[model samples]
Target: MRAQRKGPRRRRALITGSLGALVFALLTVNILLGSYTVTIPDFLAMLGGRTIPGASFIVMETKLPQALLGLLAGASFGVAGAIFQSMLRNPLASPDIIGISYGASATAVAAVVLFGVRGAGVSVAAIIGALVVALLITVLARGRGGTGLILIGIGAAAFMQAAVTFLLSRADLRNAQDAMVWLSGSLNSANWERVAILAVALLFLLPLTAAGSHQLHGLTLGDDTASGLGFNVPRARLLLTIVGVLLAALPTAAAGPIAFVAFLSGPIAKRLNGGVASLHLAALVGAAIVLAANFAAVNAIPGISLPVGVVTGALGAPFLLWLLISSNRANQGG
Candidate 1:
């Protein structure tokens, strides 16, 4: 019995450690391979507050904040995705898929195109939009089951996407270009302020997520079973859902809903962990995916830069199709 328990624990540890290492490596590559290359020694010097000519400015101002944002935002999206999937017991139930990201995107696009809002104003709008959409889903699905929530969310997302398209069509040339880039999710605007906002948000939200995660196991066992186990099923579900929304929103605000990081991270992490829900591992995987995608966007295709969302979409679409097909086959089998 002791060895049996140890085996799984050891496997979990190995998986977590491997993911952490990968995230670290990708972060290093993201920082080092930007427009102006910064060698390891110069990077250390910048961290040490020593000025090193052009290297200092590029490393400190541009690459560092971008890398940091990718790390935090990716982890935020990943953990949020894991929470929603685990709670809903559906791999397709990520915030991006359900409409939370579309909510943020629609509002942010409106702010930019209609009211000419920029900078922090757009971020604030995005957070509010995500929260409102989440609330609507919760209220609409109140008496219904997880499937109901998923269906409602999908409908809501389509509505939000239509709003976004209409707003973009009405915008002028420059604003439309800007909105399109943001909708596609780029870290081009990454700065210290954005990094600080995400860092602080995560500081508060991560604890809430961790505290509530254990309840997920009970919730996953089904509502009746969870209630019988003395869990306040509705309250727990609501709190976790709110946490997940916040997690998804903060990153969207900072980075413009960076495609499918939230959608892909949880399922991939589960596979890596041998089919167990590992939020921590998922967070690491999310961070790595963002960094790698960002890196590829900048460096993979010579003489042309793409948005991080473009790369993530290319990677996630196939996975999404596979997941849908597999789930359908499984249902048919059942």
Candidate 2:
């Protein structure tokens, strides 16, 4: 028994260490590979608070904040994704895939294009939108099961997409361009302020997520089983869902919906950790994905810089399709 327990712990440690190293390496590469290159010496110097002429401004103001946001937002999305996937007992039930991110996006876009809202106002609008959509899904899927929730979310996403399109069509050229860039999840607008907002939000949400994660594990055993074990199944589900929505909303507000970071992170982490659920590992994986994707977007294709979402969408779409086909076949088999 001791040996078996130690074996899983050792594996979990190895996985966590690997993910942490990957995130650190990606973060280093992201900070180092911008328009104006900052050498290792210069990076060290900047870290030590010694300005290295032109490099300091670029590194400190531009690359630093961008890398930080990617790390923070990616972790937020990853943890959030893990919560939803674990709670719903379906890998396809991620915030981005279903409709939570879309809910935030639709409202933020409307605020930007229709009411000319920006900055903090837009963030607030996004939070409201996410909460509203979550509530709607819960109500609609009452007693229906995970499949029902997923189907309802997909429908809500379609409606949100249409609303975003209509709002964009009504806006002027300049506003439309801004809206499009945001919708595509560009890191070009990243700054210390935005990073701070996400960081602060995480500081609050993460503890709640941590506490709720235990309940999440109980949930994986099914509601009746969990209830028999003395858990309030419905209350636990509601708390976890709310935490997941907030996690999804904050990042969407900070960096736009950023494609499938939320959708991809949990499965990738689960795969890496040998099918064991580790929210910490998932968060790290999420950060790595966003940071790596952003690095590729900016540097991989020479001369043409793409939005982070474009790259993520390109990667996630195929996976989404495969999941759909597999699920369909499984249903048919059943």
Candidate 3:
């Protein structure tokens, strides 16, 4: 018994620690290795209030903010995606796959194109859009089964996507370009302000996620089972759904829906951690994906620093098709 318990604990710790270290290394590289390289000693000196000529500005102002935002946004997307997938028992139920991210994107685009909204207003619009879509999905799917909910969410995603397209077409050239760039999700606009907002949001959401995590776990056992285990199924689901929506939305606001990090993170983490829906692992995987993808985007091509979304989208689309194929085959077999 002791051995059994220790084995899983040790394994979990190993996976967690290894991923944590990888994320740290990637972050360090992002901060220190760019067009201008800053040595560790100089980095430490910068932290200690001594400024190097070009290194200080590049590392402190550019790389650090971008890397931090990527980490936070990636973790947020991962946690939200994990919550939705685990609770709904559907891989396609991720906020990105469903309407939540689409809603946020659509609203943000509209705000940019139509209302000339930028900066934090776009973020607020995104959160509102996600919440509205969540409510719409829930209300519409109240009596319908899981399939109905998924379908509705997909439909919503499609509609909002169309909305974004139409708005982009109507906008002037300048607004269109700016909106398109933002929608493509670059870390170029990252700064201390966005990082701070996202961090504080995460700090606030953490306790809420922890408080409801117990109920979330219970929920995976089915509504009846969860109720028998003393969870109020409706409340738990609502709490988690809200949590998931906010998690997905806030990151989208900060990073412009960085293309499938949320969708990819949960399953990747679960596979990595031996079939457990580990949120922390998912968060780490999310951070790693964004960091690595951004690194590649910056250095992968000559004369162009592609947006982070481009790389993630290129990676995620194939995996998504694979998932759909696998799920279809499983259904046929079953």
Candidate 2: clashing pairs of residues: none
- Look at candidate 2 and tell me the lDDT of residue 77: 94
Candidate that would win on lDDT? 2
Segments in model 1 whose C-alpha atoms lie over 4 Å from true places: none
Provide the overall lDDT of each model, using Cα atoms, as 2-decimal numbers: 0.90, 0.91, 0.90
Candidate 3, overall lDDT?
Answer: 0.90
What's the residue-level lDDT of 161 in candidate 1?
Answer: 93
lDDT of 3 by residue, 55-92 (tens): 78888898999999999999999999999999988777
Instruction: Tell how far residue 309 is off in model 3, in angstroms.
Output: 0.6
Poorest lDDT segment (10 consecutive residues) of candidate 1: 33-42
CA lDDT, candidate 1, residue 185: 84
Tens digits of lDDT, candidate 1, 167-239? 9899999999988897898887789999998898899999998899889879989889999999998889879
Model 2, position 209: C-alpha lDDT score: 91
